[model samples]
Target: MSSSIPVSTLRRFHRSTLHPRNTSRTMATKVERSPAGEGADFRPPWFYTVARVLSWTLIPATGFYGVFIYDFGDHEHVFQPARRWAERQKAAFLTLSAEEKKIVGNETASTKP
Candidate 1:
């Protein structure tokens, strides 16, 4: 009167139906390569090599020149505001009384726990 199959019966049924006993061989075959220098190994054109070498040389050279040689002088508008602010702060610090300078210096040196 039981409707459920046993675990062994279910496993045997799954093994026979879900998986085949023998697998079929594949139809694909491997391709044979052309021998040595008959275009098996290819070299790029001369200009491509020259362009690659120039790119490797010129890009780093341009970056180093920009970092070390190029100067903006008075035309450096981006940093001018910050430079002016620093100058004003230095003037203000110089104008402070000796006691005020001591207080400011101590405030910066003290760390809060």
Candidate 2:
């Protein structure tokens, strides 16, 4: 499970690769200059600006529309059907338990103090 490479091996590889044959020549980076006046100022294209605006605007607009649809546009309207269904389910369970109690007939005494 050892993940480390030997330090000696790394040092050897670094020395072989970095030490060039001509020690007199130092590695100075060469700069290639651009022509005259092109690429001095940068301005984005028209469609790019439009795309960025649309992306930002559409994202929030979609979120607002989604919320609006959930709130007032859908058939049930703001989780009302869900609430009513839950209440009906609870009532049904209570009625079924009451029938079971009538059938079972008092097996245990009340434990409340």
Candidate 3:
């Protein structure tokens, strides 16, 4: 009974299931290179300059200050002063009447030295 099956039919079914149809979507496009890497010498944008300066100077300075001073003690002790300051600020802001809020808002945009 096994000999009744055709070998060619089994081979055709196995080949179709094992191999997928090739398509143009599977092909990769070639990249064109600039001669002597001329295009690679382009200057970074203005923000890139700002980011470089901050990364090289401001960020490190801020980190040093935070670790050495702002977070000098345990969580409760170190953050107590900042928490009190924030509470005072909130209380002062809340105590301000409508006119005071308006005045404070205006002064924020003022060019006073």
Most TM-score-accurate candidate: 1
Could you tell me the TM-score of candidate 1? 0.28
**How do the residues 1-113 of candidate 1 rate in per-residue lDDT, one tens digit apiece?**
66588989988878755566423221111111555554443544687799999999999999766654556574765556666686788898779888988998898889544
- Candidate 1 lDDT for residue 10: 81
List the global CA lDDT of all models. 0.66, 0.61, 0.65
Give the CA lDDT, 0 to 100, for residue 102 in model 1: 97
lDDT of 3 by residue, 3-113 (tens): 776999888877655456533333211112445454443444687798888899988898656744564555466556666787788888779888988998889869566
Question: What lDDT tens digits, residue by residue, belong to model 2 across residues 31-75?
Answer: 113343543323435877999999999999997566543456436
Q: Which ranges of candidate 3 are over 4 A from the true structure?
A: 1-48, 53-75, 96-113
**Better candidate by TM-score, 1 or 2:** 1
TM-score of each: 0.28, 0.26, 0.27
Model 1 misplaced stretches (Cα beyond 4 Å): 1-44, 74-113
Task: Give the distance in Å from residue 31's predicted Cα in candidate 1 to where it truly belongs.
Answer: 22
**Candidate 2 ranges beyond 4 A from true positions:** 1-44, 70-113
- For candidate 1, what is the lDDT? 0.66
Over the full model, what C-alpha lDDT does candidate 2 score relative to the true structure?
A: 0.61
